[model samples]
Target: MDGLPTRESSPGVVVLPGNRAELVAIVRALAASGVPFVARGAGTGLSGGALADSDSVLITLTRLTRILSIDPIRRRAVLEPGVVNARLSEAVLPYGLAYVPDPSSQTACTIGGNVAENAGGPHCLKYGVTTNHVVALEVILPEGEIVRLGSHAGEPW
Candidate 1:
């Protein structure tokens, strides 16, 4: 089950990766074994993306909540996928900055899920969505190859 009450799913395995290294290893093993897997960040969406079938594995990002760095000058942050949206805003408040998407579930939703789906809230009309704020992405491919998309200064596409 994810955020929606009517929705339900059962994964073959549930793994909470403690760090990027563990995550890469898990992904590699799963890929090598030909097991399907889905990455979940906070499991806070009604979209059911976090839900995985019994034949697939659910890789939860909850334990990866570290906010790696905050650059007040660029109003940017280097964060782990599980960093809560509201927490980001709170963390940057002293710098007179904010994570503006602020979806209704900001308190529970995460940067990874937001970035994955380009999330937005009512303020999107004025501030635009998550994509407007994301300058780059560091992703792990299905085969466990790590790649950085986009440039530090702007979006890739």
Candidate 2:
């Protein structure tokens, strides 16, 4: 929701990519055509950040949900953008670990939106927000270029 600009008008097109490759291709085509687009996770945001203009393209990340890996020993997890906030903690609970950023909307909010908004909840009073727990991010730039930000190895540098 952090990227969209308008709420009243529906986007001209809405795409839900099942994987990263499809997402990249869609982005590339949109860029080539000079079409404005917005990436959306869940529609659970309180702010109108997920709104789009009538001429814009909305790329919903819901189908991209996947927990790539969970390293309990390292206390880290690799996940796709559409992975739900609470679900991550539940998945790792069996490993005797948990993702700490528990926003009130965790039940329905996606991890991507939590990262976008730096969301936090009652637990944040002691644990901190999404950014503090997220170790890495695989992002697609506006020009359709994919890049990795942060290190999966958990090294800040």
Candidate 3:
């Protein structure tokens, strides 16, 4: 059971820890192997962003799904990249706080993918796109460096 399911050189997915420690390990492995890979969310992507290529690693972030913090007073929720879009909003709904952007695939789409694709949904017609609600981002770059992209009080881009 510890072995891979297929004997052939088939596409594979690795589930790593979703914490900071695990993130470091994942990055280290990718860096050491010098392999080109793609970071994927719920696999609800329509742009083929999650498709595996030759010798390409698909780093699944689904296990990282967690709502780290929610600010009812500020109407903001800080979440892991793997957190589903609709779930985040649902978590805050009781407090009258909601994530404005709602992609068609919000139920399955992840925050990471939405941010990467910069998606917009029907609700965006009045509220705006993903970037509008996102205040900040903690991204693990290709080189395995963790970087904070923006601030909560400032522009997202």
Instruction: Tell me the tens digit of each residue's lDDT in model 2 across 31-134.
Output: 99999998888977766667667789999998988999888889988889899999998999999898888877788889988887788888898999888887
Pick by lDDT: which candidate is best?
Answer: 1
- Kindly report which residue stretches of model 1 are placed more than 4 angstroms away from their true locations once superposed: none
Q: Number of clashes in every candidate structure?
A: 0, 1, 0
For candidate 2, give the lDDT.
0.85
Ranking by TM-score: 1, 2, 3
Per-residue lDDT tens digits for candidate 3, residues 106-142, read 8988898888788788889998888787778887888
Report the Cα lDDT for residue 73, model 1: 90
lDDT of 1 by residue, 44-130 (tens): 787777789999999998888999999999777999998999999999999998889978999999999888768899889999999
Candidate 3 CA-lDDT value: 0.75
TM-score of 2: 0.92
**TM-score against native, each model:** 0.95, 0.92, 0.85
1 or 3, greater by lDDT: 1
- C-alpha lDDT values of all predictions: 0.89, 0.85, 0.75
